[model samples]
Target: MFRKLIYIVISALLLFSCGGNGDGGKTKLVFKVGKVAGQSGYLAQIVEEFENENPGVDVVLEILPSITDQQHQFYITSLEGGSSDFDVFALDVIWVPEFALAGWLESLEGKFTDEQLANFLPGPLKADTYNGELYAVPWYVDGGVLYYREDLLQKYNVKPPDTFAGLKQAARKIMKGEDNSKLAGFIWQGKQYEGLVCSALEFIEGNCAGILDDGGNPVINSERAIEALAFMKQLIDDGIAPEYVTTTDEEATRHSFGNGNVIFMRNWPYAYNIFNTEGSKVKDKVAVKTMPHFEGCESASTLGGWQLGINKFSKHKDWAWKFIEFMSRYETQKKMALNVGLKPSRKDVYSDEDLVKQQPFMAELLNTLLQAVPRPVSPYYPQISLVLQAKFSEVLSGSSSAEQALNEAQTRLTEIINRRK
Candidate 1:
C-alpha cells in the first residue's frame, strides 16, 4: 500500500510539474486561430485538412463576435495585452495599418515570395501592407452591392436604378404602389459601428468626395461629403428608409431582407448567397447590382474583406504562417469560394470557369472588385472611423445637421492625425 501510494504521489507531482494533461502525453503542438461566426465548420475542416498533412500540429479555432466593431475591440485588447491565446487571427482589411503600426502583428515581408504575393487581388493585397511591410495575407474580398427585388421592380414598371436619385424615386414609387405597411422601400445598416463607417464611405465615395485627400489629410467636411450625409438623412426622414435602421447591423439588415420586408438592400456579397438559399423568402426574386452613384461620379464600393495574420507574441508563428499559406493557395481558395460563397483573394480564382458556372455573379463582381476603393489607410484609422460613425449617426438621428456633424468629424480627425504626427 505504501509503494502504491508513493507511485500515485510521484505521478501527481509529475502531472502538476508538466502543467497538467496538456504536456503529459503531448506529441503535437496545439495552436489557436480565430474568426467571426458562420465560418466555424468550414474553417475547422480546413484546419483538419492541414493537420492531416502536418501530423504533429493541431489548429484550434476561436469564434469571435459577428459585429465587426466588437470583433475589432476584441482583437485590440487581446493583442495589446500580449496574450498568446490566439496565435493566428482573421483581420478586417482596414485593420492592417493600425495593428501593424502598433506592433501587434508579425511582419511578413520575406515569408511570401514575389510570385506568391502576385496571386492575390491588388486591392486586398495592398491592404495587407503597412509602411511597405506585409503583415497579413488576404483571406477573402468583399465590397458592397445593391440587392433589389426583381419581381417588385417589374411589378411597379420601374427599371433598376443607375443613380441614387433614381433609386430613391423607384423606392418611393414601389412603396406607394404596394401599400404594404410591413414593407420598407430601402434598408441599410445605420448603427454607430464599423458597418456605419463602411456605409458612410460608400455614400461619400459615390458622391465624388472621399474621407481623405491624396496626401492622406482629413477631408470629411467636404461639400460633397455633407451632401452625401444629407441624402442618407433625407432617406430616413422621407419615410423611404425605416427609422429603426439606426439600430440595424449587418445581421439585422440580412434578416429584414431575407424575410421580404425590404424592397432594396445595400450589403456585401455574402448576403447574396444567403438571400438565395433554400429557406429565404426572397429567394429567386433578388437581383444584385453595384451601388448607385451621384450624377457625375461612378458607382463606388468600400473595399472590405478579412486577412490572416500571426500574432507578434505567438510562439508558433512558423506553424501559423504554414496555415496561412495553405489557406492562401489556389485550390483551398477555390474550395472555400465554391462551397461557402467566400470571395477569393486570388485574382485568378474569380476567373475559374467552374466557379463562375456555379456562381454566375462572379463574372459580374470582377469589375466591381477591381475598382473597389479602400478606406483611409492610417495608423489612426480606428479613431478616424469612430469619428465618422458618430457624426454620421448624429446626422441620421437629426441631432445634428450634415454640415455640423461633418465639421465636427473633420475637427476630430484632424486632431487625431496631427497627434499621431
Candidate 2:
C-alpha cells in the first residue's frame, strides 16, 4: 500500500554486481526521481521527452513519494550501500550534507560547464554545494507564503499584517470578532515532519537566530528561539490558532484553509494555486503574500527545495548527467512550474510571460525564495530535525512548554551530534 499510493512506485531492484561494464561500455542510465504519486505525471512526461531528445541513452525515471523525510531515510539506506542500479536521485536541500558526507554524489564542478552553472539561481547553487564541492542541482524551489482570506480580512476592515506581533494581533481580532470558533486564526505545518523544520526555521531566521558557532550547531534554545516558540504556543493556547494544529501537516492544514476554516496559512507556494481554485471554498476569497516578520528581522522564509543528484554507483553517469541537465533547463522548469504550480528553481522563470500571466504571485514568490533560508548544514541534520519535530510536536499539542521542548530538543540533538562526531 505504501508503494502504490506514494510517488512514482519503483520497487528497489536487488542486484549483486559481480560483473564488469557491458556492451563495449555503452552506459545505461537509470534516473530515479522522487515521486509523489499523481504528482509524478509532469516529470514522467518530461523524462519521456528527454529520452526522445537523446536517443542513445536509456533512461528510466522512478518517482518516489519522497516528499517526506521518512522516504529520505529509505533511499539513504540504499544509496549508502553503493546501489549501482539507482543512478540519478532527487534529494531535499537539507540532505546535501548527509549525501555529500557519504560521498554518494558526483562533484559537478568539472562536470557541468561554467555556462550551465551560470543559469541556476544562487540559492540552489549554494544549496547543491557541500563543503567546497558542488553536488546536486536544484530542480524546483518552494518558499513559505502567507495566505489569508482576502474578503474576510477586508470584511473585518483589517489589512495584512507586516510583522509577527501585528499578525498575532490581527489573528486574535479576526478570531474574536468573526465566527472564530468556526475559523482558525492562523494555520501552519506543526506536525513532526520535514515541514515543521521549515516552519521553525522561518521563525528562527525571522527572529535573528542564525548564530551557529561551528559544526552548524545552532543555539536553538536561545532566548529568541524560546520567545518565538512561545509566540507560536500562545497562538494556539490563546485561541488564535487551533489546538489541532499540533497534528496537522501541509495537507491537513491546506484542506482546512481551503475550506475557509482558517484566516491565515503559512505554507509553500504550491498552496497558491490549490487554495485559490474554483473547487476550493476559498476561491476568489483567498490571497497570498510574503510571510510576516519580527521586530528587527524582515520577513524571512525557509529557503529550500529539491535537488537531482547522480549516484556515484550509477552505471550511467554520462547519460544520467545529461538527463539531469535536461531537466535543469529553464524551459523544462518553466513547464513544470506552470503544469503543477511547483515553483521553479531558476531565477529566470519568475519573469516568464506565460508564468507571470498565470501565476501573479511570482514576483513576491521570487523575493521570498531569494530570501528563503536553508536549514543548518550538518551531516546529522536528519537526526537534529527528528529531535526538534518530536519536541515541537509536543509543544504545539500543549503536552510541553516551548522552553521545555526546545531544551529537550537541544539536549537530544547535541547528544546525537556529539556521538556522531
Candidate 3:
C-alpha cells in the first residue's frame, strides 16, 4: 500500500510541476480580434473553436459597434498609441495601406509563404497587399447585391428588372398597390457611413477615376462623379425611392426590409441569413442578385469585408500563424461557409457540393465577389471615404445639388492630398 501511495504521489508532483494551476506554464499569448457588436454570439462560437484548437493561447475578442468606420478609427487611436494588448485585429480591405504604412503590423514574411497565398481569393488578397508586401490575409469577402420581394414582382406579372429604370418602374407598381403603400419602392444605405460609399458604387463604376484615382487622389468632383450622385437625387425626386432614405443606414434599412416594408434593398450577403431566418417576414420569398446598373453604366459592385492580421508585438508569432493557416485551409473554409454565411476566399470552396445545397445563390455570389472592385487602398483612405460620404449624403438629401456637392468634395479632396504631400 505504501509503495502504491508513493507512486501516486510522485505522479501528482510531476504533473503539478509541469503545468498545474498556471505555475511556470507554457507561454500564454493573449490575442485580440474585432467582432461586430451584438454579433458576439456568432463570433464567440468561432473564437471558442479557435481557442480549443490552440490550447496554448488565451484569446480575448472585442466586438465593436456596428459602424465599421468607428472601428477603424479605434484602430488608429489604439495602434498609434503602441499598445500591444491586441495581437490580431479584424481589418477592412481599405485599411490595409494605413496599417501597413504606419508600421503597425508584423512583417508576415515567412509566416504566410507564397504557397499559402494560393489559398486566398485574388481580389481580396490583392487588397491586403501593398507595394509587393502583404500585411494581412482575407478573412471573408462581401459584395453589394440587390434584394427584391419575389411575391410582389410576381403579382405585377413582371420579370426581374434587367436595368435600373426597369427596377424603378417595378418598385412604383408594388408601392401603389392597396396593401403596399407602407412598402417603399427602394431602400438603401444613405446615411453618412462607410456603407454610403459602398451603396453608391453601383451607380458610377468605371467613372470619376473611382473615389481615389490610381495615385490615391480624390476624383469625387469630376464630371462623372456628379452624374453618379445626380442619379441618386433623381431616384428620390422622381419618387422611385422615398426621401427619408437620407437618414437610413444599414440597421434602419434592414429593419424596414425585415418588416416587409420595402420592395427592394441593396446590402451585403451577411444579411442573407438574417433576412431568411425563421422569424423574418420575407423568409424564403426574397430573391437576391447583383446590384443592377443604369442603362449605359457598367455593372459595378463595391467590395467590403474583414481581413486577418498578426500583431507585431506577439511573442508566439509562428504558432499564431499556424492557427491562421489552419483556419484558411480548404476544409476549414467550406466548414465556415456551412457554419456561418461568410463567403469564402478560395475558388474551389464556392463549388463545394454541400455549399451548393445550402445556398444555391453561392455560384452567383462567388461571381460577384470575383469581379468586385476594392476601394482605394491608401494611408489617407479614411479621409477620402469621409469626403465621399458627406457629399453623397448632402446630394441625396437635396441640401446640395449633385454638381455642387461634387465640386466642393473635389476641392476638399485635393486640399487633403496636397497637405499629405
By the TM-score metric, which is better: model 1 or model 3? 1
Better TM-score candidate (1, 2): 1
* Model 3 worst lDDT window (10 residues): 20-29
TM-score, each model? 0.90, 0.89, 0.88
Q: RMSD for all candidates, in order, please.
A: 3.5, 6.4, 6.2
Per-residue C-alpha lDDT of model 1 across residues 1-421, encoded as one tens digit per residue? 9999999999999988776346333233334444444677887788789888887676666677666767888888877889887778888899899899889999999898898788787888788898888999999899888899999999989999989999999999999998998889888889888889888888899999999897989999999999999999999999999999899988899999899989889898998888788988988999888888999998888889989888898888888888888989999999999888899988899999899888888977877788788888877888888788889999999999999999999999899888856
lDDT of 3 by residue, 1-421 (tens): 9999999999999988776346244445544555553445766676677778877666566666666767777878878888776666678888888888888887665566676777667788878888778888887788888888888889888678767778888887777773555768887898888788888876767343367777677777677777777877898998778788888888788889889888899888887788888988989879888777766665677888888787776666776676666667787678777877788878789999999999889988877787788877777778887888988888898888988988898898898888958
**171 Cα displacement, candidate 1 (Å):** 1.6
TM-score of 3: 0.88
C-alpha local distance difference test of each model: 0.86, 0.79, 0.77
Model 1 clash pairs are none
Best by lDDT: 1
> Which tens-of-lDDT digit does each residue in 1-421 have in candidate 2?
7757443333222122323343344455777766653467777788778868876765666666656556687677888687887888888888887888888888777777777677777777777788878999888887788998889789878899888888888888877788556788888998878788788777777887752545566578888888888888888878888888877888898899988799999988777777666677877887888888789887778777789888888777878788888888889988988887787888888999999999887987888787776777777777777788887778777888888888877788778867855
